[model samples]
Target: MVSKHVKRNYRIVRYVLYKETLLNTREHVWSFLGAFCGIGLLATCQGVWQDERLTVLLIGSFGASSVLVFGAIQSPYAQPRNLIGGHVLSAVIGVACQQLLGADTWYAAAFAVALAIIGMQYSKTVHPPGGATALIAVIGGPQIVAMGWWYVLMPVLVGALVLLVVALVFNNLTADRAYPTSGRFTRIIRRRQQGGRGE
Candidate 1:
């Protein structure tokens, strides 16, 4: 009695949510711990270390990074190289665009993100947070720019390092979890060299 389209939709939903769904309480504990640590550190730093107000973007980055890194631990997307390189590259590109593009607002924002993504791809360090880094740079006020590249090193790099360090410890604590993939791509390259067909 089921229509074909309805059957297809049901299958899609099941597949999408099936294995990835967190039915186990242990899974929730690990995932939440990663996310909480990242955000908590950032939040604590806001008032004590720096007077800057926490923006939605920074908060979102902290939360999303945790999810990407811990929640999907096996994914190449969350690897340490991708996490740090992507952000650093984007930060540099953003500063360069701000200097060269002359604050055209929308143009700078758009181009910085696009360019940063392209750069990341070429560098083989594609991470989701890099986009935000670029956007931050383009729209960042004079004070941010005045920080003169040190801003990238201080808050961005330092924050990411702290989050990553915490994830490394917490993720590896459980027998089932592994933190910051060691060298997946290297293994793949070795396989390819040995004639393992991959497309």
Candidate 2:
């Protein structure tokens, strides 16, 4: 006789393996397009706005965010609130850590990331890329250090918005892919469509 615990363990193993073994080409294509457009838009902005006083429109953390927001659209971390709030909050913490501890020390970077994680958790917007966003503020060189509070507005918030917009558009192009699995906006849109059909 199989014990219930053993059976449950076997089922879990099977589920994990099954998920890994499956291939979804359609899903991959959409993820690719979404990530490409999201990052490409930021890159284009950086190129267009380059000048004597360079505005940093692109940040490395956005690459990690692209993986979640586009490739793993259904994840809670990839949602609009998480994507935007996490980056913005983390950037604020990062800037504060740099200011308080001085960006030159390694501990400042560690402290920035650690505090950012706590901030995200407490705020209910735990996006993994936010850790990197915090670290970047500490070690991102003179340009970023110089930006100070402005970092939250430009590359962090602006870049996050761009990614969110692209994810919302491309992820909805296919019937199977929904950028946000559930949200008030989705409900409102559906209700309006139903009303329009009745009319």
Candidate 3:
């Protein structure tokens, strides 16, 4: 004879707990390894070049990128094109905003992120972390500002490529997991399987 309120609360709690449970422990482990190696390699490269330390290596948005690229492998936002194009385009827009409006101003930071979102949407590479990438350009201090357009190539493009490589290797190690779960790679795989089956 549980009260109706008590039963409703129990159902809600059960639903939340179920959603929070991990479906596969091995997938989580692979995701952890991919992010670790990817970011580690980028950081190591930056550390090796003492002069570029300030402008190269890690960016805060990369951490968010790792979560999507590794943990959420099936998400369209985590796909290779989105990860690379989103960050590169956002960085370019961010640098432009900083140069035009000056990095110190609050408006510049806000507008950079807003414009980045619009650009990513238009480009069909709408990654959530690109907003942070855009904001970092506006507020990343003198070192980043000095790098200018170079920032778009180095930390944005290079770092993303490193992550993608690591994800491809690590995520595919498991039979059930496949990196770049959609797009051209998926099509190629589907075609191969169809050919194998003689369909």
TM-score of each: 0.78, 0.85, 0.88
Tell me how many residue pairs clash in candidate 2: 0
Residue pairs with colliding backbones in model 2 are none
What lDDT tens digits, residue by residue, belong to model 3 across residues 1-199?
5799899999999989997784888887888898899888888888887776344768999999999999998999999889999999999999999999998899999999999999999999999999999998889988888888888887888888888888877776655677788667766655665676695
True-structure RMSD, every candidate: 7.7, 3.5, 3.1
**Residues 26-122, candidate 2, lDDT per residue (tens digit)?**
9999999999999999999899997723469889999999999888888899999999999999999999999999999989999999999999999
Question: Best TM-score goes to which candidate?
Answer: 3
Clashing pairs in 3: none
lDDT of 3: 0.86
- For candidate 1, the lDDT comes to 0.74
Model 1 misplaced stretches (Cα beyond 4 Å): 1-6, 17-22, 51-60, 183-199
